[model samples]
Target: MEIGTLQWYPGHMVKARKMVLENLKLVDVAVELLDARIPMSSRNPEIDLILANKLRAIVLNKSDLADKSQTEKWRRFFSTEQGYPCIVLESQLGKGVNNLIAAVQELAKDILEKLAAKGRKPRPVRLMMVGIPNVGKSSLINRLAGKGSTRTGDRPGVTKGKQWIRVGKGLEMLDTPGILWPKFEDPEVGFKLAVTGAIKDEIINIEQVTLKLIHILSMKFPEALKNRYKLEVLEEDPSETLKKIGVKRGCLISGGNVDTLKTAVIVLNEFRAGKIGRFTLDELS
Candidate 1:
């Protein structure tokens, strides 16, 4: 399957956009969550337009799975260059939760002061969490709320509707369904999204995506492939390398042939799980 042929935009995403726009009036700030590994690809480009004029901050979730040095560069890029307050987060473990709250509150401090000056009662900062599917928005919300206030899954499009949940004092968040744009103009973006589990595996050709991943790792992180799969040598062909990995891991079918599908699944799962190595696919050149 050609990477360019992969295009995913369900009708629900259209509704998601409407939902976000309607709720924008209730939000003081818009927090955009991006996967730390594929920061560029994981971002919903339309978010900037939809959240325009609203105070915005970025949270780089799943930082533990991305290259540490590159993550730092991205942090500087978004916070310093892009002029959005950025926070590095490992949402699964609740790391950086406090920092996120502090940063957001600081961003809304002026608004809080304005209310005080007007003799109006102070209210918690209302935030709308937005991001592409499977970018860890729900996990971050759950971490902040200190419970499973929203349903979460490893797959994409898990959150179907919006829900408002109050975190501790001075913080309330509106959780919305993940939204991807109508189409990907760049094929590499689609491949990155698919490789990172932002797109559902059932809808895409996993074998092709895995081959692309192997080719990328072979060039950029050869040592990771060797170390994780115990491959002493990698073939020039990614397909051959995948077969070698299959043989090493014993993914064989009848007649002792490598089960390419199973092998692809394994490689993709391991890559997403960060078992291969910490990587940052969207390198800043």
Candidate 2:
């Protein structure tokens, strides 16, 4: 399947764009959350235009699921090259929650300082959290608030409306619905998003996605595939490799034929859950 021909911008994403624009005036800073595994692909291209002139910071969420060294390189690329304050975060575990908080506070300091100079009362830092679907925006908010303050799920578009939640005495955040652009510029970007669970499984061909993943793992992290699936040797063809995995894992029908669909789901779920291995699909270069 050609990923370029696939389009997933639904009506809700259009609403999400309008919602962000409407709420832009209500926030002091914008925190863009990106998947640590595919930082370049998971970023919303429209964000730069929407957040122009606003204090912006990048949070590489789900850092624990990505190669630690690659995540660091991405952080430096965004911070040093792109001029966005970047922080690596494991939102599910709250590993870098404090660093995110500190980064936001530091970015908002100038806004607060100006208010102080005018002898106006200080206000809590208002933050706008934006990202592509399933990039861990809601999870990060929950971690920052230290509770399930916002709705969260493994699938995309879980948070349909905006919600204001107080994280601390001096911090509050506006959680918006995850947004995707009308179209993807690169088909490879779509593939990356599909493999990473940012796109709904029902929207894409699961078998093709699994084969693509197998191909990538075979080339980049062959050990992960071999070790996780107990394969002594990998087949050059991903379909053949998948069948071997299905047979080993006992995904078979009455005729003893491997259920490739079931096997695909298992592999995709395990990959997203970090059971396969820590990997970074996007490279710095």
Give every collision pair in model 1. Answer: none
Per-model TM-score versus the true fold: 0.91, 0.90
Give a tens-digit lDDT track for model 1, residues 1-285.
365355445666677778778777768888888999999888877767888889988999999999999999999999989999999999999999888988889999999999999999988787877888888888887788785343322323424354667777778787553354534678888888889988777778899999999999999899999999999989999999999999988999999999999999999999999999999999986
TM-score of 1: 0.91
Among these predictions, the greatest lDDT belongs to 1
Task: Write down the lDDT of every candidate, Cα atoms only.
Answer: 0.84, 0.83
Q: What lDDT is reached at residue 59 by model 2?
A: 93
lDDT of 2 at 74: 98
Among all windows of ten consecutive residues in candidate 1, which has the lowest summed lDDT?
149-158
Model 2: residues with Cα > 4 Å off, grouped in runs: 1-5, 9-12, 147-163, 175-182
lDDT of 2 by residue, 121-196 (tens): 9877988778887888878877776753443223224243556677766787875533545347687888899999
